[model samples]
Target chain A: MAYEQSVYLTGDHELVEEFGLLCYQAGYRVTGTAHPGPVRRKLPVFFRKSTLVPRSATVAMELTNVRTDLKRKNLKFLDGALPKGALLLSSSVTVAAHEQASWIAHPERLIGIAALPTFGGRKLIEMAPAPQTGKDALARSQAFFTRLNKEVAVIQDRVGMVLPRMVCMVINEACFAAGENVATPADIDTAMKLGTNYPSGPIEWANAIGFHQVTAVLEALYRDLGEERYRIAPLLRHFAGGNRWWET
Target chain B: MGTGIAYAAALASMDALLYDVTAEALERGFGKLRADIRQSVEKGKLSPERSEEILSRIRTTGALADLAPCGAVIEAIVEDLAVKQELFRTLSGICASDAILATNTSSLSVTAIASGVSSPERVVGMHFFNPAHIMKLVEIVEGHQTSPDALAAARGLAEAMGKKPVMAKDTPGFIVNRVARPFYGEALRLLGEGVTTAEEIDRIARLEGNFKMGPFELMDLIGIDINFAVTKSMYEQTFGEPRYRPHIIQQQMVHAGLLGRKTKRGFYSYPP
Candidate 1:
C-alpha cells in the first residue's frame, strides 16, 4: 500500500478548519488544534494544548495571523515538536521566510508560504524558502502545493510575499478613499469593476478577506521595509479593529 | 472620447452639438459616430429609424459658438488645463449664464479648469471611461465651487445617458485612477525585485485572485506611456505623497519606447 501523507495544521479554530478542509481536498490526512490565545499571555504550547500531532505527520503548518506571533512562539514550538526531517510550512505574509527560520532548532525542513484563510479555492499557491531550507524541503514545498493542484510561485524571500503585498496595498488605498468619503462603498465598487475590471471592489474585497490580514500585512511591510508608503492607513486600522466596511 | 460621448448622448434621445475647430475633425467625428450607431442598429440594439434619428440628432460644427444653444456642453477636448480653462472662459461668455459646463477630463483637476471661468459653480466633471458608449460608469465630480444644482444636473444627465454616475470630490484621479494605481505600481515593484516573472504574476492574479486582467496585461492594453503619465500626475498632484509615487520601472519602460499593444512591446513580448 502507498504511504499516506499526513499534515499537522495549527492556528485559530476557523483558520485551522479552513486549511484542514483544503488539505483534505488534496487527499491528505489532517489533524489540527485551536491555538490557546496569544503566547504573550498563555503558557507553553505543549502544556496547554490538548491535541498532539501524530508521529507519522510529514507536513507541519503554522497559520499565525501576524508575523510577531510566529516569531515569538509558534516557530520554536513547531520546530521542537515535529519529527526529524518533516517539512514545516509557516505562514509568512508579514514576516520573511529567513527571519522565521532563525527561530527554529532545525530550519532545514522549514519553508514559508502564503496560504491565507479561504484560499482553498485559489489556483495558485505562493512559496519562498529560507537560506537554511534543504533541497528536499524546497522540492517538498513545490510537491506539497502540486498535490493541492495549485501552481507554485517561488519568489524572492520577502515580507508579505508577492500577492499579499500587492493586494493589500490596493486594499489600503481603497480604505483611505472610503474613510475620506470620496464615494460610498457601493459606488466605489461599481467604479472599480466597470472602470478597471478589478475582481471586486477594493473596499469590499478587503472586508471579504477580513481587514485584520490587510492591516497585518501593511504593518509588517512598513516595519520591515521602513518605507513611508507601506504605512497603514488610519481608516484601515479602524476596520481591522472589529469593524466591517460591509458584511459578507 | 468626444465622439463616443456624443453617440451616447444622441442615443439617449438628446440633441447633441459635436464641436471641433477643424472641418476635417468634425467630419471624422461624424463618420465614426455613424459607424458606431450602424453597428448598434445591425445588432438589433436600436431600430434603423432610431439609429438614423440618433445620427441626425448629432449636429457637427467648426465653431465653438454653436454650443451656445446647448443646455449642457460637455467638453472632451485635449487634456490641458490652460486650454480647458480658456475654452470654458470663452464658452461661459457665449452661452447663457445658467448653462452647465462639464469637462471629460480624467487626470486634470475639475477645480483648476473651473477657475477664472464665470460662475464656477456651473462647472463639473462628467468623466466617462474609454468607449464611453459602452462603459456604464461615469464619475460626477464636484470642484471647489461646483454647486448642488450643477451636480444634480450632471447626475441626471449621466443617468439619462444610461450611465451609472458616482459622486466624488475633485481629488486627483477622482476615484478610479487614484485608487487603482497600486495595481500597476506594486506589480512593477514586484517584477523589479525579481520576485516573479510578469507571466507568473499575471497567472496568479487571474487564477488566484480572479481579476479580469493581470496588472501587466492591463498596462499593455492601456499604453505604458499613458499609464506612466497618469501615475506621474497623481504623484505630483498629491504633493509628493509616498503612496502615489510613480515606479522607476514605468519611466524606464516608457523611455525604451516599449509601449504596450501600440508599440507591440512592454512587460511582455508580442510577436506581431
Candidate 2:
C-alpha cells in the first residue's frame, strides 16, 4: 500500500533482491534497501517476528503470509497514530481482511489482498474488502494498483482468500511426498506437469513462493482453522527455517 | 483400460493379447479399439493398411491361460486392493514365471497387490494415465519386493510405447496422484466452507496460477466421484493423514449422483 517508502518483504538478502528486481520490472523505483535480513546457512540461534509498519508510509502494504507476525508486529505498530487514513493493504493469505481489521483501530482503511511470489506477473489480483473497509479506500487502492497496471478482483473475506491458500497448500503436499522419498522432487514435478497438465509442478512452485512463506501459510491456517490438514510438514518447516528449497 | 494398453502396445509394433473375464467385456474392449483405430485412420494419423495391421497384431482372449506365452501382463482392472491382488495372483499362476506382472493401478498399493502374487519380484506398477495411448506420462512404480529387472522392464515398455516414465516407490498415491491431491482437496475445502464459488476458484486458478483448469473445474471434468474416491483412498492408505482427507461436500455430491460431466452434474452442471 505504501508506494512512498520501500515495500517490506520476508526473505533474507535473496528475497530483498528478487522483490527489488520484480518491483523494478513493474516500473516502480527501487528506493533504498532497509535492514539486510538475518544471515542463514547455519542453525538459527533464535526466532524473530519481523518488524512492522514504517512511520512515514502513506500506504502500508503488509506482505507477509504469517498471521501472527502480521498481528503482533506489523499491524500492531500502526496503533493509535497511523497517519489518518494511511491505506493498509494487508496480505490476506492466512487471515481474512475482516479478521485482520479487528486488530487495527480504523478498520475502514484496511483491505485484504491475496498475493504470493508465485502469483506475480498475473494480470488480475484478488482482493477481499472487510465489511468495515471504506468504499473510498477500496476505490483509491484499486485506482493506485490499476495505475500500476494490475486488475483487482474483490471476493468475500475469508482466510487464505483464494489463490494463495490453494497454491501454498498444494506446495505443502508436494513437500510431504518429497520428504518421504515417495519420489524425487524432480520426478514429482515432472509427473504432475505431464500427467495432469499442471501449469507448474508443486516443487517448482515451492521455490518460487519461498518455503518459509509456504510454511507460514500452513501455520496460520492450522492456528485459525484448527485442522490437521493445515499442519505444516516437518520437511517444509525445516526448509523455511533454513531459507532453503528442494533442489531441482 | 486394457484396450488402451493393447492399442499402445500394438501401435508400438509389439504383439498384444487383450484379455478380459467375459465375452461381453472383451467385445466392449474390441469396440473401443475399433473406434480408436477408425478415428486415427480418419484423421490421417494412420493409413488404412497400417491401422488394419495394428488391429491384426492385437488378439482378444477371455482366458488367462492364453497369456502364458507373453513376456508381460499389465492388469488394468478394478481399483480395490483385494480384487487387484486376487487378479494378479491368478495371472501370476497362469502367466510364465519370468513374465512381468504389472498393475495399472492409480490408487492401490503396488506392494500390497504384489504381496499375494507368485514371484512377487516380477510385479511392478506401470501406471498409465487414462487414455493410455494418448496421455504421455506413465509412472513406473517399484513395489517393496519388485526386482530391478522388473522395474527396468516396465520402464522400457513405457518408453517404447511413447510415454514418459517416472519412477516411484510403493507409497500411497505414488507420484502424480499424491502430489496432485491438494489441487482438488483444497478447492473442495474452500468450497465446503463457502469461501468462494467453484467458478470463481477455477477462474483464479487459470488466470492467476496458469493452471489449465481450476481444482473445481478439473474435479468436475474428472468425476467428483472418481476424484473423491482417490482422495479417500489416499487418506485411508496414509492412515488418515489430514492433508489427504476427503471433504464432506464431495461425498455428498457423490451420494446425490452428481458425479461429473458423465452424470450431467457435479461441482458445476453440464447441460445434456
Candidate 3:
C-alpha cells in the first residue's frame, strides 16, 4: 500500500512548533517539533529523496527572527535541506519572502506567511509570493492554509507585510510617548482603546507581542527602507536589551 | 462651553452647574441636554423618571462666581490660550483652594494654562471628547506643577463621571493624538503614491487590521479639517519631525473647503 502522505515540519522558532501542532490537530500528518535537528536523518523514508516525491509533503519553516544576518543564514541552511519540489511556506515578518526565496534553489516553491505568532487561531493571514513563485505553488499554499481554517490575503511582496508593519509603527510611536513621560503606559493604552477604538492600547499590545519582537521588525524596516519614520525609539532598545526592565 | 462637561456630570448623578457668557447660551446648552435625555428615554435607554432626575441635578448660570461652591470646575471654552489663561486666573481666586480646576483644551499647553494662577498645582487637564456624555475617555493631564492630590482628584472625577481616565503629562497632543499620527499620515502616503485607491486601502485595512473603520473613512467621519488641524499642530509642536508632518493632500482638501461630513465634501463627497 502507498504510504499515507505527510508534511515534514522543521524549525527552531516558537512559531514553527505552533504551526506544527496546528497542522497535526487539523489531521495533516506532521513530523518534527520546534527543533527538528535530532530527528533530521530519522525522518520516515517516505519524505526522503525517493523515486516518488510524496505528493502531499510540504515543508514549513519559521523565519521569525528579524535579524537579517541570522535570518539569512538560517534560511540558507534550510535551503540545502529542502526536498525538491516540496512547497515551502516560510514565515518572515519584516523581510520580503521574495528576497528570502531568491537565494533558495526552488524559489518557485517558496511562499511567505506573515502573521504574528501570538495570533494563533486568527482567521486572517497574509501571504506573499516571490517573483518566481508558480501559480500551482501559490494555489497549494492557499489550499493548505484554508484546510487549517485561515483566510489568506495575497499581497505584494513587502517587508513587514501590512498588519505587522502598521502595528509596529503604532507601538514604536507609543514607546516614544511613553519614554517622554507624556503618559503612563497604562494611560497610553487606555487612550488608544478609547480614542481610536483600537482593540487594545499600543503599550499593552506591545507587551503581548514582546517589545523585543516589535523592535526587531522596526529595526529591520529602518535598515531595509532607510526611512526616519521606521527608526527604533531609544527607549525601546533599552527595554528590549534589558528584557527584565518592563512588565509584560 | 462648559455644557458638555456639566451634562456628563449630571448624567453621572452629580449636581452639575453649567455656566457660559450669557443666559441665552446657558439655556441653549440646557435645551440640548434636555433633548439628549429625552432621546435616551425615547430609545428605551433610560427610564423617564431617571432622565428627569438626571436633568434636575444640572443648574445653569452666567456668572463665574456661581462656581465658588463647587468641588471641581471644568472649563471647555474657546481654544484661545489667552482667554483660557484669563479664565483660570479668575477661577483660581473664586473657587475654594482645594477645588480641582480643569481645562478641556485638546491642544493648548496645560502647564502654560496653569502658570497664570496662584494655585497652579490644582490646575489639571480633564480633556473630554465631543458629545462628552457618550464618549468614555477623559485624559487626566498632569501639568509640571500639578500636585499628586490634584492628579488623584482629576482621576477620581473622571471615574465619577463614568469616564475612563488615562493619566498624561502636559505634553502637546498627549497620548492618543500623538501616537495615532501614522494612521492618517501613512494612509495619505499610500494614496498619494497611487498605492491602490482609497477604497481598496480601506477595504484591506478593515480586512487585515481588523479596524472598525478604515483610515480615510474615519477621517471623513472626524471631519478632514479638524483632523488636519490636529496633524498640523502636532507637526509644528514636534519641531518639524517628519513623522508628524501633514500631507499636502490633506492641506489642499482643507483649502478647497472639502471639510468632510460637516461641509459635505472631503476626501469623498457626501450628498446634501
Instruction: Give residue A140's error in model 2 in angstroms.
Output: 3.1
Judging by TM-score against the true structure, name the best candidate: 1
Which candidate comes out best when scored by DockQ? 1
What value does the TM-score of chain B take for model 2?
0.96
Candidate 1 chain B: worst-modelled 10 consecutive residues by lDDT = B32-41
Write candidate 1's Cα lDDT for B1-272 as tens digits: 89999888887888888989889988888888788778888999889998889888888888888788888999999999999999999999988877899999999999999999978999999999999988999999999999999999999999999999999989998899988998888888888888888988898788778888899999999999999999999999989998889888989989999999889999888888
**Tens digit of per-residue lDDT, candidate 2, span A98-186:** 87798877889989877666465776778889999999999978975675467777788877778888888878888888888888889
Model 3 lDDT tens row, B118-200? 99999999989877888899988999999999999999999999999999988879888888888788788756755346775
Candidate 2 is scored at a TM of 0.87
**Poorest 10 consecutive residues of model 3 chain B by lDDT?**
B193-202
Q: What's the CA RMSD for each of the models?
A: 4.0, 5.0, 4.5
Location of the lowest summed lDDT over 10 successive residues in candidate 2 chain B: B187-196
List residue ranges in candidate 1 displaced over 4 A.
A1-3, A12-14, A35-50, A70-72, A243-248, B38-50
Superposed by TM-score, candidate 1 places the C-alpha of residue B201 at a distance from the truth, in angstroms, of: 1.8
Ranking by lDDT: 1, 2, 3
- Per-residue CA lDDT of model 3 for A7-45, tens digit only, reads 655443445556665676566666543433212333332
Residue A124 CA displacement from its true place in model 3, Å: 1.6
- Model 1 collision count: 0
The lDDT of each candidate is: 0.83, 0.78, 0.77
